[model samples]
Target: MASPPPPTSSAPTGFSLRKIAIPAFGPSLLFGIGEGAILPIVPLTARDLGASVSMAALMVALISIGSLLNNIPASLITMRWGERWAIVVAGIWSGLGMSLCVLTSHLGLFATGCLMVGMSQAVYNLARQSYMTEAVPITYRARALSTLGGVMRIGMFIGPFLAAAAVHAFGLQAAYVIGIIGVLGAAVVGARIPDLPVPPHPAGQDAPATPTLVSTLRDHRRVFLTIGVGVVLVSAVRASRQAVIPLWAEHLALAPAVASLIYGLAGGIDMLVFYPAGKVMDYKGRRWVAVPSMLIMGVAMLLMPLTTGFATLLMAALAIGFGNGIGSGMIMTLGADHSPRHGRAHFLGVWRLMSDIGSSSGPALLSLLAASLSLALGIAATGLIALVAAAVLASSIPTRRTGAGGAHEK
Candidate 1:
């Protein structure tokens, strides 16, 4: 770990105080904004190209695969080439790839572009995070990360509305074009940010890579299993909820806009409540927060098919966000916290891989389960799985809070 700084309160919080923070967070806002600008049109885009429901869903599926493949490569590139350059390169690739997406009528080609976006997103995020941890006071680390979540929520808020308007007006292709532009803008911003200078390696004996991916798996097996199971369970819940909610709403003849509004509310709550959630983790305990949060997610799944209008659906969204805010956030921080020295890149890579795997399979699993069964039942099953995983995760994590409020090194 990098040498610790003085107390956080002594650090600046004004403009000059945030020099590293702003530069570090700016790219995320750009990517988040880009996400907002395009994510709404995926299904419409596929439909416009004459694809089946499953084929249209490929847009989301491929992104997970892309993220899964890129996790290790992204972290590896950061270790070798440094943060600023790798992130900018990722931005450029995502922009260029998405721009080409406007020309493709094939669902496969469209999905491929989405994959590149995930790959680029992985690298940019990995590099940006490494920079944040190294440069900031450890006490402020969770706050710094929470700030990004808020910014992304802001982007998500604006993005879907913009995508809806753009797709409704010009076309889905135009929406993608706008997304590419936003990604490119982020790349330009990243290019201007300077690379952090590496702190010198300790003197005496040197070795090659520590906790190589294999060793990391060996050492952290139980922790990974617990976390991985939680991830897949939640991912499945999210997938089922997202898939069924719109269809359910439509069956009642509700406007599609109401469904979009539901997601918007979830994003808003996630951003708004994250700081307090982090504070709870710091002052009280993370496991306490995480376990109940998982339970809440399960409850939200049960609540989904019951709501139709925007307002009621918003309640479900809040439940989903509340659960994710505590559980997933803590899980990610724990992944970072548990990583051995000189092995952060690999361990984080593994973390990202697990997330991608869960998300990739999540929708497909729901689709298969709901094929013969009711979507509501599939969703309830998701909740049951979450409760099981939460039970396991609660047992695994230490009860008391640690570093930076729960971000302490092992």
Candidate 2:
């Protein structure tokens, strides 16, 4: 394949939604549906296996843990196979993992299966993002990526409903089976579709040395420590919001059905904002989207503990969902913005690792704080941390776009 032309200011004149939607969107949605279906059930499945609440939480944690462990390897795989094949492999791997979860009676095996699902998901996610980096024009980058985030959210929004039907007809294990079917369907779509061209290393020059994870970190140390740290905090806040919401519902004595409905409503609100956010990012700047989004989330978290009933909690949930919606593809967008055209897969892998770490840490931090003090204190502390992260981000990420992938920026 030819090397992509150097960054152009005039926006690829003919760019449209179809260019991105055809191959990437379908697979991403399906993959997300499968993941969403399984996520809520993992803990329940663990509990049924006689695990304690804490242990069940641990089992669920395995998903992020697996992603953290596999991010670098998955990036390497993408580098080797290119985006298309990496996606194909991720779907197959996820299916295998779902099957293991469905078939296993042993808790250990089930956790292993969940871990596999996470690993596959990480690979799948990176491939799609990398493909977009290579394929989409500069002007549409944020909108395209945010739309990708929107599609995933759509699937996630739909998934539990599907899981409910499957479980109602069969059992809890049926959800995993549904997840497997989703994965398989996504795999088929990804396999059949044509992939965007990946540019080859420049003509006549030796390929650039493949940077190891350590070197990538060292090389990008400044961004990672500054703006990157804010992204990590964003991840932490997002994860903590997910963890805290359900626990808050439980604390308020809401029934499972009510809690689910409330949470789903929040998700609905979240799904509504993607396009506008993307538009803002593309036109105004990333910080505009990033700052308000985090501020909203921080305020929501701070207000959460003050809620005395389902109605108040619902308000907080809506705020969180709104915040999350506006920041739909924040991390992916930032990573893509910073990644060079050359050796992008490795850089993205490192980026994913940072995100995965934040994701894992959020829940861990919540659990620790709640255990030592109170859930309210823990929740409030998380809110304060998010507020701080927003400040960091405001001061960090470059204020001007230097074309697609921020190719010209340091």
Identify the leading candidate in terms of lDDT: 2
Name model 2 segments beyond 4 Å from true: 1-7, 198-207, 401-410
**lDDT by residue for model 2 (1-410), tens:** 21223445656667787865858799989988998898889999999988899999888878888889999999899989989889999999999998998898999999899899989989998999998877777677778899999998898777888999999999999999879988888889899767766467778999877667677667777877887899889999999888788899999999999898888889889999999998788776788899999999999999999999899999999999999999998899888888767678888998888888888888789989999999999999999988998999999867765334343333
Residue pairs in collision within model 2 = none
- Relative to the unseen true structure, what is the C-alpha lDDT of residue 376 in candidate 2, on a scale of 0 to 100? 96
lDDT, candidates in the order shown: 0.67, 0.86
**1-410, model 1: which lDDT tens digit per residue?**
22113323333345232666556667777777786676657766777878888787777666656777899888788777777788788889888768756778777788778888778878876777666555544455555655655565566566666667777898667778678877787888888787766568778858645557787777667767766566565555555555655665665577778766666566556666766665565455556566787788877877776776667766777788767655434545555445554666766777767766766666667667677787767666677767776786677665545433344323
> Could you tell me every candidate's TM-score relative to the true structure?
0.83, 0.92
Best by TM-score: 2
State each candidate's clash count: 2, 0
Error of 2 at 94 (Å): 0.8
lDDT of 2: 0.86
Please list the residue runs of candidate 1 whose C-alpha ends up more than 4 Å from where it truly belongs after superposition.
1-17, 49-53, 104-109, 164-171, 203-211, 238-240, 251-255, 303-314, 325-328, 403-410
Task: Give me the displacement of residue 288 in model 1, in angstroms.
Answer: 3.9
